[model samples]
Target: MENDKKVIALAVRATRRREQLGGLVLVAPAVVFLLLIFVAPIALFAWRSVDNAEAWSALPRTRAVLRAWDGTGGPPEPAAAALVADVNSLDRSVAATLARRLNYSESGMRSMVIALHGLSLSLQKPVLEQLIALNPRWGEHRIWQVIDNESGRLTPYYLLRALDLQLRDGGLTKASDQDGTFRVIFARTFWISGIVTLLCLIVGFPVAYVLATAKGWLGRLLFIAVLLPFWTSVLVRTMSWILLLQQNGILNRFLIDHHLISAPLTLIYNRTGVYIAMVHVLLPFFVLPLYGVMLKVDRAQIWAAASLGARPLAVFRHSYLPQVMPGIVAGLVLVFVTAIGFYITPVLVGGGGDQMVSYFVAFYTNSSVNWGMAAALGTLLLIATFVCLGAFRRVMGTAAVSGR
Candidate 1:
């Protein structure tokens, strides 16, 4: 009997292992695809936020010597030889990358580095003296201070700049008011996203409720109309709005012809246009999830409350809001997070004052070739999104529990 039991147990174990192996095989492709497309890119973004390999890699000798010496006026005598060796060994392309990094601290630095490379052909005197002669800026304590601050492989410089601060005198300090560009952008991004989310909720919740509760054929037709926007491309929709909202465009022309206004309103290329375009695009995101949740709600309870002499507003506030709270939270998060990272809609419609963090991120990434700043901004935006979503969820959850 004991032998028979052991054989049964062995059979069960074998069967379980085969099932687990099959499940792994089925899941492997999806896991690999997600990691490659989503996880890998996000990891690279976060890594780039702190990665300062170019600084130490370009100035290996300088980094070594500077470790023991205190960061006072300037680096010691060997620092000059170390710098000369570092620059002489680098090709123009490599020197250009290092120059670009240095130029973040001091303008006109790329030209100086390029010129020094040109001077490398005629090294009559020490390269250090040549560097100073090439540009007096190279002899300044501030220039050396920038290099010393950026000697580490991993640095908080990108992150600091993202937050409108900088590392100076071995500690973090407020960057120049002029350099405090990012924080203002961050504030504007969140503020715009908040307004967009609120606008969407004001419009979407009623639309979702009506659609979810409407009668058969008309309901289906309305649903299709709601979903029609999804079929068209976002760019097309945005451009269409521009054509309609521009001065003397369809909307303004109609209003003028009808004598509703004396002149065309300043619509497109302003905050008004940004709000209109974004709300139009993002309304579906807020509505669909909420509509799905609303479909699952027990209409019987709402009617039961009404039958018991509950007012319409009371039925909605007391009976309706609690059940649909999850969907509302989901919709809010989806819209707000999406809105904060908006680029195309805002860029196409918004004025300079209305530009968000994404505009600068794209600028740093594509035009300026400043990946560090771009990565830092993107990562910080991601963190802010998560933090806001978490806080919203918590507050909504608490309200839900207490209301019930």
Candidate 2:
């Protein structure tokens, strides 16, 4: 009997192990998919923010020489010689490429570098003297300092610039007032997203509540209406809003025909238009979650509260609101995150000043071709989204524990 029991125990252990292995096999594809599609791309993008390969690659000899030279007084003779040699070695194409890379660190560097390339061919005197004669700025300590500081496999320059900060005199400091625009733009993006989320909540809550409480056919109709926007492309919806909101479009024309306004209102190409379009696009996100939560709420509990001398408003505030709080939180997070990343709607419908941080990310990536700066901006936006998501998870976890 003891031997039989041992055999049964071993059989149970083997069976459990097989089940665990099967479960892992089932989940392996999903894990691999996320790593490849989502996590890998984001990690690569964040890496680009600190990757400083261009400078080191372009001026390898100069960088090696300057690495030892203290960034003070003036460019040393050896460093100057190395720079001239590096410039002389480069063909026009390579020199131009290096010039463009250096210019990103300091303006006018491209011109200085191109000029140096020309002067390097005919120079015979001391390299520093020739360089100074070519351009007096070469004698300045700051120029050499920038080159030396930027010659690294990794750098904080792009990340610092994203936050409107810079390296100066071996310490990080706020960039000049004229250059301090990125932080302000980030704040504007957050502010606009918050406003759009708030507008969606205000407008969508009633619609969701009606859908949740209405009779069968009416509820279905309202739910379908709420989801109708999802059928069309976002670009189509935004363009439709433009046609309706433009100064001489359908809305203004109707108001004029009805004698309700003196002139066409400035609606399109402004913050008002941006808010309207974003809220319309994001409203379904809010309503669907709220409707789902509200549908499960116990109407009998609300009725019992009303029977116990609670007013309708008190019953809603005390009973209905708590049940739907999770949905509200979920919807708020979804809408805010989505709004922060909005690109086309703001670009097409709003003015330049109203454009969000994503617009600048695209500008750097596509137009300016500054991959480092673009990646830095994208990283910051990703961090902001993750922070919000973490806060939401924390709050929701606390709410769940408290309820239990």
Candidate 3:
């Protein structure tokens, strides 16, 4: 009987192990799919922001020597000699590539480097003299510093430039006012996103409440109206706004005919247009999530609070607000995150100053062909989103604990 019991136990263990193995086998394909399609691409793009291989591609020996130097005085003779030898060995194409990389940090290096290749016949001259002879500007400390900064296997060049800073010998330096508009643009992006989120919350809270509590045909009709925008393309919605908001558009015409205004307003191609378009598009995002949460709310608690002699506002604050706060915070975060990444709507409706980080991101990717710059900007934007998400989570946690 004992032997029979042991045999039965062994069989059960085998069956359980087989089931577990089968479950893992079934999930393996999906895991691999997400890894390849989602994780790999994002990791590669983020890596591009720190990629600096092109900096010393044609001058490896010189970069190696520069990397070891203390960087106080002139670049070591070995580095200078290496530069001369490398320039002579490589063709103009390779030389031009390195020159372009260096010029990203400081201007004039392109012409100087391309010119140096033409003048490098002397293998006998002193290292500094040979380089100085080739180009007098090469003798400057700034030039050597630029080369040394770019000598690393990885760099902060793209990331720093995105923040409107430059890596220099003394440490990070603020970019000159003319070239340092990224910080202002970043601030503007946040400012616009905040306004849009606030507007969506104010408009959507009442609408979502109405939908959640409405009866029969009224509820269905309101739901259909809310979902209507999602069915239409974002571009179509934006163009519709353009047709309505442009000078002499429907809005101005209606107002003019009614004698509400004497003249057309400066609406399009400004901050006002951006706000109108963004609020309209984002209102649904705020409403739907809050609506779902509100549907789950027990109306009895609201009635119970009122019956306890609490005023209407007190009932709302103690009963209804606590229950729906999670959804409200979530919707606010979602709207803000979506608004900051907006590209087409802002570009179509807003003025030059109203353009956000996404505008510059597209510029770097498409027009300037600067993938590193684009990647850095995108990475920063992503970090901002994550930070906002963290803040939302914290607020929700505190609210849950305090019941406020």
Best lDDT goes to which candidate? Answer: 2
* Local accuracy of candidate 2 as per-residue lDDT tens digits, 55-142: 7777889988987877777788999888877887889888888788777777778898888775633456788887888888888887
Q: How high is the CA lDDT of each candidate model?
A: 0.86, 0.88, 0.87
Model 1 lDDT per residue over 1-100, tens place: 9999999999999999999999999999999999999999999989999999887799898888777778787546667667767777889899888888
Each candidate structure's TM-score, on Cα atoms with residue i matched to residue i, is 0.91, 0.94, 0.92
Candidate number achieving the greatest TM-score relative to the actual structure: 2
Candidate 3 lDDT, 241-277, residue by residue in tens: 9999999899999999999999999899999999999
Count backbone overlaps in model 1.
0
> How much lDDT does candidate 2 score?
0.88
User: Which residue runs of candidate 1 sit more than 4 Å off their true CA positions?
Assistant: 1-14, 118-139, 177-179, 398-404
Better of 2 and 3 by lDDT: 2
RMSD of 3: 2.9
Using lDDT as the measure, name the better of candidate 1 and candidate 3: 3
Candidate 1: deviation at residue 216, Å?
1.8
Give the clashing residue pairs of candidate 2, or none.
none
Off by over 4 Å in 2: 1-7, 118-124, 177-179, 395-404
How much does each candidate deviate from the true structure in C-alpha RMSD?
3.1, 2.3, 2.9
Model 2 shows how many backbone clashes? 0
Better-scoring candidate (TM-score), 1 or 3? 3
